[model samples]
Target: MNLIRPDKIIVGMIHVDALPGTPNHQLSVCEIARKAALEAKLYHDEGVDAIMIENMHDTPYLNKNADHEITAAMTVIAHEVKNAIRLPVGIQILAGANKQALAVANAVDLDFIRAEGFVFSHIADEGMMNSCAGELLRYRKNIGADKVKILTDIKKKHSSHALTADVSLLETAKAAEFFLSDGVIITGNSTGEAVEPSDLAGLKSEIKLPVIIGSGISNENIYTYWNQADVFVVGSHFKLDGHWTKGVDPGRVQKFMRTVHSLRQ
Candidate 1:
């Protein structure tokens, strides 16, 4: 958990395209791995603090454990990206496959995993996603992978929080901290959307763990959250045209890093 210092750390996202067995599957596993490695290199060269590889294109994501093929493919891609870049790398399996992501992180010697549905139940695109803090921590312990930090999403994107409507986002973050999460992720309604500073401030005051902004960061808005957020998880803005599905744009990455560095000084 202390691996990342409490600064405006920038964690780039390598949104790996659909793996085999998913509905959107297209490229061969090797091709996908190559592309991921390339993106990892780009992030490293651009001085990104860390990078997280996710199975974002694997549409129609599962609410439970992912298939063996999906896990295997992610492992392969992660391994390649790990070798390609010196920056710390992490993994996040779509929809709430926390255990699978942990297993992959363990196998690839990754620094961490981005877990969804870590605190409360909510309706995600895949289905009703349940909390995994208890089960996930136990599994991480059983496997002796305590070195792998779990940065969980509280009130995660692409989900409805009607079930936990009575509770506040700050309380949800407190629950995550109580569960011993390495850090807590805050995000907008969906991918590529900007996180509200008020929401970021709310969670910052409530939890002692690292408060990471999980989406919608760019050179344009980085100044706003530069001092408020501990870490920024950027994906869409790094891509060409600021779309998650597009290839990484080196210029965008360079611009973002420059701005972040200036703020640090």
Candidate 2:
């Protein structure tokens, strides 16, 4: 079966609450899981094509590796979310924790993962991140999780790409495709920022893999990327008041899905 639809795929993000290891840890793991499951149900009910649970609230993220506690906590939350929704579920551990995210997806029987630092070396807020497509794919093979698709980000957000300024975005995307990424995501400079329409157009024109719009999608500007992008991963806009840290607003989700449905027609 296809992992996602042939038309525009709408993925809603569940910014999971601060896990135990992070500085912002306030709620118990059970509480956090409950909240995540509720958000997943909200997205499923509101007509999202898929749901991605992320450890976005884990500030001061560890570079490239998540602690065992973070992984265990995420597993619990991911299980709860999987039970709550029938739509395709995915996970992303912040700061390039692709392996842990894959482990969680494998355990929870998730469909996909949003991986960062998959192809090129760049300076992220967490520090310098190098390409991991080789090691990550090998790990996936070892763990027997090849069924879980890896949708990678090229020149991802919250990073400095000056070291690779000589490389164009298309070249970066080609590298990812060459490295065996299932799909490629294009994002803006940071969270909640709009992606350049020209960049989206350029990449779509050249790349044959699935092209995902990873940030800054909303009811107002969905038209700009309607035809060029295969998937739209929305987070901040679905929350209360368009803030990433707030709870999922049902009204906002309904409104946005309505717009997407109209576009699909």
Q: Estimate each model's TM-score.
A: 0.97, 0.98
lDDT of 1 by residue, 132-248 (tens): 899999999999999999999998888899999999888998999999999988899999999878887656666688888999888999899876778899999999999999999
- Top of the candidates by lDDT: 2
Off by over 4 Å in 2: 1-4
How displaced is residue 196 in candidate 1, in Å? Answer: 1.5
Q: Candidate 1, 198: how far from true, in Å?
A: 1.3
- What global local distance difference test value does model 1 have? 0.90
Q: Candidate 1: misplaced stretches above 4 Å? A: 1-6
lDDT of each: 0.90, 0.92
